[model samples]
Target: MKALEPIDRTQRAQVVALTGKYIEQASRIFLRHFVMLPVFFDLSGRLAGMYKVHGRTRCIRYNPWLFARYYEENLAVTVPHEVSHYLTDTIHGRRGIRPHGKEWREIMALFGADDQVIADFDLSGIPGRSYQTEDYRCACRSHRLTHIRHNRIRRGWRYYCKSCNTELRR
Candidate 1:
């Protein structure tokens, strides 16, 4: 597998332009002014793109490594996937509907893009994050939990062992 490299300026510009085009198409289809959301290439790992809302701020984030690895597919599928999320949020407010539910599917159909939720790609050369894990014990065996799950356990969430059917403990 080839080592991962950052996408160059021209490729980045093409992604931005394509995002704009999709946003325009959605705006026209919905007959509503969809604000051009900011696009960022700061994401990593297996996710290709995400439509994120933090408080009142919102932006579309793309994994540069994945984009560089799968340029054409990212341009065709990933762009529309994230844009459809943005459009669905704009129209339905993201409360009552699921992420890839009917509203999102409708917008995807309007965009004429595949409605598949995730891209299937070999991630051998792509850079990904490694989470630190903590060991826990059940009756039958020990389990390793990532930091996210460890924190949740500390916050009063309990995880059970499937074979032993007992709560995992530190």
Candidate 2:
């Protein structure tokens, strides 16, 4: 994670061109429904890019914030990642295959990607999802754990009390 870079004409052009090239290459490999797809950019915080197949028009909506931060580093993989997703979606005839299933993985490998299952970006500044907690009673005392921890106990991982060394029960 580096600071966000200022994406300019060169960066924008490169992203568009690279996406077009990958689309062409994928078309050559497999018969796709559409040959040409539009690339769009925005200042998105969560998503790096998205392969939107609306009716007949296939498009890539990317985050300019990422473009400003990592410039080409983000696009080099992100663009192809979205394209692979498009391939995965198209190959399955739209919406049934897993997002990062075997087909998508194969496509990534073909495009020189390392088969990365998820994005590798900085999310330290992003707010974490909070959870509610419940109190569980042990032989010695009561302890508070998140709902997930409580569920783990219910599912069969008997939590222990550190001080008393006893199993906490709900």
Candidate 3:
């Protein structure tokens, strides 16, 4: 991995702007009561973004790493994807509905995104993050795990290889 790069505030500004645009689109059309929500970015790796509500205030927490890695796609798709979640959640308001239910799909369709998106959100070419990874080995293969996974393993957590059914060696 190369040196960790500084946070790109320009990209962050772009996300903020695009988020506002999505919120506007949702408000102007289907969701009559839709309103703008706050957005924050973290270095999360598991998900692109998530919509959360605190009492009457709704917000979005997203991964800056994703937006930095896939700049255009994140602007066009990822931002709008979370916007769908925000809109659907506002419409339902914690009635225990599924995140990607039929209503959410309809909103996504309004943004011209079907189940298939044209942009390449794939991370195959993205190099391992600037953070270090620890080496581990199973009977079948060697693995390099990120710090989060290594920490989990250190806490008495064991991972077994599916093919060999053998515990990984740290």
> lDDT: which candidate is best?
1
Off by over 4 Å in 3: 1-7, 31-33, 116-170
Question: Over the stretch 1-170, how does candidate 2's per-residue lDDT look in tens digits?
Answer: 66444477878888888888888888887865546577787546667778887787778888777667666667667888988888777777656677888889899888897667567778544323467999998888899999999999888898889998899987
Q: Which prediction has more favorable lDDT, 1 or 2?
A: 1
lDDT by residue for model 1 (1-170), tens: 56679798899999999999999998788788999999999998889999999999999999989999899999989999999999888888978899999999998898899999978988887888888999999999989999999999999999999998999999
How many clashes (backbone atoms < 3 Å, residues ≥3 apart in a chain or on different chains) does model 2 have? 4
RMSD in Å for all candidates: 2.7, 7.2, 5.1
User: Where does model 2 exceed 4 Å of error?
Assistant: 1-6, 31-34, 123-170
Which of candidates 1 and 3 reaches a greater lDDT?
1
TM-scores, all models, native as reference: 0.84, 0.64, 0.63
Better of 1 and 2 by TM-score: 1
Count of backbone collisions in candidate 3: 0
Count clashes in each candidate, considering only residues at least 3 apart in sequence or on different chains.
0, 4, 0
Ranking by lDDT: 1, 2, 3
Scanning candidate 3 in windows of ten residues, the lowest lDDT window is: 116-125
* Angstrom error at residue 105, model 3: 0.3
